[model samples]
Target: MKPTETDSTAVDWRGDSASSPDVTRRERLKETYEARVRTPALVAWADWRTRFGLLIIGGYVLMALVAVLGLWREPSTSQAPRLLGPFTDMSYPLGTTQSGVDLMALVIHSTPTILILITAGAVWATLIAVIIGTVAGYKGGSVDRGLMSFSDLVMAIPGLPLVIILAVTLNPENPVVLGVIINISYWAGLGRSLRSQVLTIRENNYVEASRTMGISTPRIILKDIIPNLMPYITVNFVFAARYVMFASVGLYFLGVLPYSTQNWGVTLNFAYSNGALFSWQAAHWLLAPMIAIMGLSLGLILLGQGLDRVFNPRVRTRMAGESKSTVADDDDDTVTEVF
Candidate 1:
């Protein structure tokens, strides 16, 4: 049927009206998404706990750097001045041990030992955990049962007593060997947790979709699954570091690894053996190593907590409540809720 010009014009205007609403809706959605992303990164960084946690970590790094520089500088005959009272001589800042070696210098030298132990233990534990977990989780049934049994076996043994026996058997004079022994004590529980997480992640729709696309199992696990589990791995690593240090210190304290290779535990061992524990004058000697251990552990704990807030929705909400954002959606039911 032939139409009048007015009718044709009216049909064209109706077509435009139908399309306008959708385009406007899409634009609105795009703007909202952009705002959501940019706004949260800024707010998350500005949160007081995040700042406080970062500050704690930053202080530890600074102390580590100072210790490194102190080690790097040519050996000085003139020792640092003791400031912490009778526990140390006037020449030494923290004081000297019964051997008359500067506690400050020993502490500075020991930073490398602590760093090496933590790094070595974390690497081995993380590697073993990720491999065992991903493999067992992705291949269930018999494989899962076997791995779970193995994890249980490892967990059943008391850790410190075993570490002491092994450290004494190895009779480690080197920090690296000590670290490896310590790592042996750390990976099992982490592996079990990681396996559980991977089991759940493998069932995710995106993972199934990838599998349907003919992606190989290993590739899918590496690309699709492992990345999502990284936050959990990081949290475990922080705890692993503390655990390794605790084990190392336990060994040294128990007289299992007694040689002083500038290790803090060795320093504490020497201090305790020399009547520093009983004498009020030698308290700084006891205090120095204890403080370093405490500070390092506290920093890692707080950093782990901050990372939890960054990763876990539950912790994020608590942190956000403390920060108090008025416009931010606090509803738990919405998928779009950030924390």
Candidate 2:
């Protein structure tokens, strides 16, 4: 049937109506952003592995916060259960160190400091990687050669030996210094990887279009390239945090760094040096810190692998069949109520 002039004149512009309106540029951009940015996070959260990994990570964070705030019982309370074995008493859970330090309290309290160190180191390293990789990859030529030469020089040197020397010579009390040294030690490899990623991003249609439209290199890289590489960045950042953690803990455990602080690594060092392993009864002291370190490392690795789905398009595509939207339909079901 032919519509009346009044009905035809009053166009229903709203998108959700029976006569669906044409999609606007703004709507397209919004959908694109959601698909590229928000959907992956939703997808990752929906995955069991990702959810479990996040739970582990969140547990540590909560424990660390409690410890740092001194709300995890009293520091003096840790001394009361001194020399007692695990499950010996409800008050003295997890036993105590020879120095009368409460085992659980010590481990919990030390968690925050180590987390801060590794997180800081990872951020520093990621920043270096992005800057160097983007510039080298995008600019290409003498800049690439010079930057690659610098990285090569550092990479050629024995990493462990260099880290040990630096740690021993520097102030061990300052976590910032330790974090910086870790960044210096590991940024080269990630920088190279970032450069390779940028090289690929350079050929992307949006990037080329921006270039053709007279956009500056730096702006284009920042606005377009970096956003695309978020998944790679997130994955690498997780790995880098885990790497520095292991390195720092190993250094502390080996007695290469000062043992004045109450840290898991320091506790392990003292436990080993003081013969905590001589008797089967004294196992909890060493085992406690060891377990914490292993848990942290495993959690980070799992988180990284899970995060791969959010950033890597290939992985996302492969998992597409399995991942369903978390959002519920507006009119999908009925609710039951009784008076």
Candidate 3:
């Protein structure tokens, strides 16, 4: 007895099944990579603003690392002539201060201190806001009223004056301590705003469903609620960092903070005190730190704006759909070429 044509074809199909698992495995890996890596990269790259912001931020970070690791010349070492105007010498591109401190080195070294101060202050403030906001919004009633009242009381106090008083009293030299002191009055407003957001989020169906379930309050807030609030929280963190940067620099400029040669604000103060404002030859001394401060602030502002599209549900969905369609079109073209 001979096999029928259909039976012979069936045998070939069965043999093909041996490779099916491998094909499926490969497909799963490809999908995971696309979803986790490629898609996100494309989404981020889609925005030119994000790219420019990241470029500026990366440059600052690189410079900071170089300064911290002593990859460049010591900023304190006076290796150049005093008050040499910028571009006068290739070695001192940014020129020299009245004391002959390398202006470029001073700018570079100041990067890490400013970055650390903002990061510490922002993280601390954001953490406090998230905790107080989430709890107050989720718990509501007496807890909400109590927290709101306290926040309002804190907000009533003048922020800058309080920071000045604290700076004078504590006289902190460490960036971290100064950051905390600077932002002591900063969190209440952000927390109140966040509480408003959480109030809306808590009323969402998914959050309500979690509440209906036997899920613990803490677990629900952490897992279900916080994730939804992340986009807002991230933007606010950047805002908080910017606030800290300005406050710290202002304090240093006012001579409230202990003098440090490495500080940009102190550099500004020195340049001013030495009459750099009136002297045309000393203009570079004043402009260097001002440019650095403005550049950093610009980067933060651009980054925050760009992150809105990346984290926003509506924007992300639209971009992701476009990305998928683009990928599909590419795949179709490839298949057409093969055929």
Candidate 4:
């Protein structure tokens, strides 16, 4: 009992760390899960671009929620006056359109629609990537050849053209279908990326050990292989979302589908087509959707940048750990600071 206690005490002494609540691994993990795993934040408060990126996105999302709850009363076309410039009227702050639709409410209301499209698109793309990539990469030979051939075929088609063709054919109303169409076009690239990563991971010593220990292939994939690729997968998912956002906007701008005030693309198209740009009185109507889209894009892009740091263990270490100093000749200063 004495020897056992001594051994335990030695282990604890060796591993014990002086940690504050804010800097502890547990706190960091919680923040990571909340920001990266849940939605997204940024790398550092010092980085103004990333900070504003998250702030802009979060602010719009809050506004959208307010709109959804009916707390933001949109001035109806039938009762309210039209073309009121921003701050001129308290009833419709930010003004109303030529048709008397409250510009603030229209932009705010469209927030959920945009977020839903990107999120649904990301999930669909990631799911397809995991399933096909894991199976194809892990179970190679004929399976790999078949899957790669299919991926190649899909990649060969012009993505925007294919999406336009499909949109024209199906005539979808639900915004979810736009996300699905993007998945069909974009998942192949993600699957290919994931497949390569899985192949590299499958050859690792830990994975090999699992394979030799009578562990099933599915278990090895789910418990061992996939976990290693999640960071890579997450980064790619953000990229996929970026693609979906811009593509959907372009599609809607072209009038490929029915217009909804809930869609920023439609809002932009309506504003531009109806001479809002020429009418300086109602120019905010044109710029509102543009601002909304830019904010969303910038947030996702910067969040992805921040996530690149988080997902990288070395980057995470350099950011959170302060134990090392740089070598004079190191190419990456941040990387070199870790001893």
Candidate 5:
């Protein structure tokens, strides 16, 4: 008796057979699953630069957590003699400001605000850029022209001056609101760049295939386009965060932003206002915040660089190949020992 076309037994069950179509299909599915399941953060950890960046960022987070839990001296409370130089007292490691507040506590407490500022700003900018850019590029025609034109208009405005004006006008006290205000001019440039990238991405065969298959535009953009654009998006997010950090700090240092909260910038402002820059005894006050800013910025920049490998298919494939080869070698050694 001949097997029918729908016969269950007619289908090959041997997925291990090299020549079997089931094997090919299974392998493809496995690859797809692995690709989707692997997160960029975990993939980025293989790079030494990412590890170092994480260490720096993690230290700041730990400090912030410690402050939040009240594990250390309050940043506002006087803990030692005013203007006591660092190393003068074992208890006050980073010394005390002119107000007798512990400099180390100030730095630690400032972490949460700075982190929140950067995070909020980056998220806002990146979200706007991705949405606008993706839509403008994918839609084309009048939609593209309109979006691009608006973006160009925004790009024409001077970023810093506009931010300063907004800061003065809004008088935002909330760090999140302050972050959004500072990044007002940031999304336009990034959006334009992302639109250009999207133009190229939308022309790819897979995207075209999706379009031909009558897939919804939103689905195509979400599934096909965004995944491919992850590397650019990740890098831009870091860039946006860095810009927010610097801009917010500058605004605070200049006293344009309301001093409603503890901040690294506010610390710097107070330090310089109190003559920390000119006096040797007060130098620690100025230098501590400066070092913190630089360290945090360095970590973000390094993490961005390392993250390129996490999302770039070619780089990720190469890394995976190397890992597999190493595993294969170890397996051979283990098998030989057993034999």
Candidate 6:
């Protein structure tokens, strides 16, 4: 026992104490506690800066539902304009056109058409961007030069004047047909921007590894490049929708589109023709369409903002933290030290 005690003292003197094992383990446990438990819990409960996304998505959903409902109903004649509900007078609930068409019915009926135009244009434009961007960026040389030059040529043509010229020349009566034409003017710039991004992403080591592993060019583009480009594409879709809507309205306002259609722009034109803006009693007619446009635009803007917060990891981290100290704590503890 005396020898054993002397050996233990020697070990301790050499700074190899065993009595501190429990303390070291406890320290390890504390570190584990902070890493595995506290950090995640704090992040889970923290405030999200992109809370507005839900609201934006909700608004779009509501508009879609309303449009769907309107699809089933027959167009109502406004011989005697009834206010919005069952009891109101000849004045429409929303108001009436000079021809006595109910504004509410017009708005409801036209919603789907507008949604179709917006959705189709957005999707088509985004597709053009992704395809052209990937091809031009991944394969430089003659291909890049030819595609980019073509893109620049398309961009140089002014959208409004060109759209007006096309509309006047084609005289398209169908909304869907006209919408397709509008998409042609939008994809060039979007394609160029996307191509620039693809050029940057393609040079990364991961893409190089995929190439070294002999991944097919199609596989690399579709499986690898496209997925990573989703956030940008999603945002671009929303912006494109807004742009298409504005273009559609502008064309309609200028009488370049079919005048008989119950589009929002047509309604605005009719309201102006009927002096709705100048007449105090008819001001609501002009105001309602303006409000609807603003609401839709705002909802899209908010949704895009929410998506930005979600897709950007840095923004996501910031969104995940409620307070400054909690954020700092997270940043400080992000790296694990192995011993």
Which residue pairs in candidate 2 have backbone atoms (N, alpha carbon, C) closer than 3 angstroms, thus clashing?
Answer: 78-102
- List, residue by residue over 77-181, the lDDT tens digit for candidate 3: 767899999999989999999989998898898898889899999998999989998999999999999999999999999988898888888888888988888
Q: Encode model 4's per-residue lDDT on 113-188: one tens digit a residue.
A: 7788888888898888888899899989999999989988988999878888888888876778878886676889
Model 6 TM-score (2 dp): 0.71
Reference-based lDDT, residue 133, model 1: 88
Ranking by TM-score: 3, 5, 2, 4, 6, 1
TM-score of 2: 0.80
Give the best candidate by TM-score.
3
Lowest lDDT 10-mer window, candidate 4?
320-329
- CA lDDT of each candidate? 0.73, 0.80, 0.87, 0.76, 0.87, 0.72
Candidate 5 lDDT score relative to the true structure: 0.87
Candidate 5: list runs displaced more than 4 Å: 1-33, 36-43, 326-339
TM-score of each: 0.70, 0.80, 0.86, 0.75, 0.85, 0.71
lDDT over C-alpha atoms for residue 113 of model 2: 77
lDDT of 6 by residue, 1-339 (tens): 356988878977766566578789999998787544664444333434235545654765666677677542334545654223322553455666556567666776777677777778788888887788889999878999999999999999987788777878888766667776788768899999988999998998888999999999889998778767877887898899888888888778677776555778887887788787797766666776777777778777766655554445464455445445766777777754421
RMSD each, Å: 9.1, 6.1, 4.7, 8.4, 5.4, 11.1
In candidate 3, clashing pairs total: 0
The segments of candidate 3 whose C-alpha lies over 4 angstroms from its true place after superposition are: 1-37, 333-339
Q: Candidate 1: which stretches are off by over 4 Å?
A: 1-44, 47-91, 258-260, 312-339
Q: What local lDDT score does residue 157 receive in model 1, on the 0 to 100 scale?
A: 89
> Lowest summed lDDT over 10 consecutive residues: which window, candidate 1?
71-80
Clashing pairs in model 1, backbone N/Cα/C closer than 3 A: 82-92, 82-93, 87-281, 88-95
lDDT at 111 for candidate 5?
89
Model 1 lDDT tens row, 16-104 = 99999999999999767644554444444655666676786677666568777764331134344432454335456666655556776
